[model samples]
Target: MGNVILRYINLMVVTLLILSFFSFSLAYLFPGHPIENLTGIRLENISQIENTEFNYSSGESLLVQYWHYMGSLFDGNWGVSFNSGLPLYDEITNVLPASIELSAYALFISIFVGIPLGFLAAMKHHKLTDYSLLSISVLGYSIPVFWLALLVILIFSLQLGWFPLSGRISLYYEIPDITGFIMLDIFLSDIDNKEAAINNVIRHSILPTFSIALVTTTLIIRITRRSVIETMNTEFIHAAYARGLSGRQVLVQHGIRNALMPIFPLLAMQFTTLLTNAMIVETIFSWPGIGNWLIQAIYHQDYPAIRAGMLAVSALVVIFTMSIDLTIRLMDPKRRRLKRAAI
Candidate 1:
């Protein structure tokens, strides 16, 4: 166990370093200096822009600029946004929490609901339950995210009047910003009237969360169902059945455990998918998250912000993939032995 963990840690560190280097290189690959593109005021006087005292330069050697850029990255100085003229870190930090919150909610919904439905579908096989679940899964998977989000808004917000159409809360309410997550903020705030905050947060979150969760849940269900079916047909499962174990006992004890071994890796891959979905959902709901911020940054051609956003997302993808690989190794001891031998 210790060796496995150590190996994963090493892999994670190496992957992060490689990704960071790639991000830096990609940022520099874009035509023209990011600063020049951002400022719009080119420095005709090379000497003035190159002054060591002011630390403002356009004529510095490429090597020097590269080193300075790398150094700034280490110091968390991602430069100013050309479009907003605001510090990149400030913009990222402000929007990231909202994205995280949306992702967390969607993830929770996916796991809790998707896994169970999948398990049931697998147990039922070609029965009515299975066919019904498969049909719903097909619909959930096929629906386009933007269209689904709009349909949800129409039904729940416009037609039914059950939820808010957009934004995190009612404009009239004085919401105390604690964690930037509307739900958490409501819980943390010492507002005299708790009802208003609770109601407002729930009303705002339902549509977006449901939209994002529907797609992810469908995916998880499919993965879970496939894994469970495969596991149920294995030799070990047949042996358990032959040993006079009840169907329920055999499934719960032997089947689900083995099924989860494969399902875990698929779950890890879902992290990246969830993040991507969160971005789309955030935009639809006008939720304040990193995804929506990234869309805006791209539109305005804010290179610094774009670089930061892409780096963050790519880093997340790498981490999640590595994590899934490590999890598979941990769950399947044979894989770990093979990995160790290969190493």
Candidate 2:
């Protein structure tokens, strides 16, 4: 187990170095000087921008600049935003929580809703329930996230008034930032209307969460149904059924568990997909998250912000993928057997 973990850690280190090289190369690989490109200013005198620490000059070679960049990473300096003059790392800290909160809710909805629906669809096979779930999944998959968000906003927020149209919380409640997560912040803050704070957060979160969740849930349903169906037809499942296992027991202990093994890798990929989709969802809903922040940075051509955001997002995906791979390897007996045989 320790050896496996060590190997994965080594792999992650190599992957991060490669990612850093490519991401840091943005400074030189891009057409103009980083500062000129970022700020849209043409300075004839190098001395004008030379004194400033943020500006990239023609004097420094890419290797030296990359060495400095890598050193800064170790020193916890993730560069500064050209547009805002704020530390890129600090900006990431501010918006990351919202993304995490939104993603968590979306994943929750996908798992709790999708898995059971898929299970039922697989169990019913050729029945009405199977056909209905397939149709719904197709519809959900086909709907663009932004459109779905707007549609829900029109119905739930504009017409029904059940949820807020946008934002993370209502201005009516003054919630302080404790953990950066609004729900946790509500609990920690000394707000007069705690109930109002919680309610407001929930109301504001529903539309965007549901919008992203619907798309992700559709994917989960299809994957789960396919996996379950495959497991159902296996000879091991039939053997288990013949061993006096009831339908529920066979499904729960054997079928779903076996089906779920394949789903782990899919879930990891879905997590990154959710992050990308989250940027769009965040933009539509005007949610204060990394996605929205990155979009603005791009529009303004903030090189530091762009580099930092890409690096952070890439690191997240890589770390998550590694964790999921390790977990699956540990849990799956077949992998363990293969590992032992190879050793």
Best by TM-score: 2
Tell me the TM-score of each prediction against the true structure: 0.88, 0.92
Question: What does candidate 2 score on TM?
Answer: 0.92
Weakest ten-residue segment in model 2 by summed lDDT: 50-59
- True-structure lDDT of candidate 1: 0.80
After superposing candidate 2 on the true structure, give the runs of residues whose Cα lies further than 4 Å from its correct spot: 35-42, 49-58, 338-343
Query: Residues 229-254, candidate 1, lDDT per residue (tens digit)?
Result: 99999999999999999999998899
Q: Could you tell me how far off, in angstroms, the CA of residue 230 lies in candidate 2 after the best superposition?
A: 1.4
TM-score of 1: 0.88
lDDT of 2 by residue, 113-225 (tens): 99889899999998999999999999999999889888998998889988877888866777777778989987888878888778878878888999999988999999999
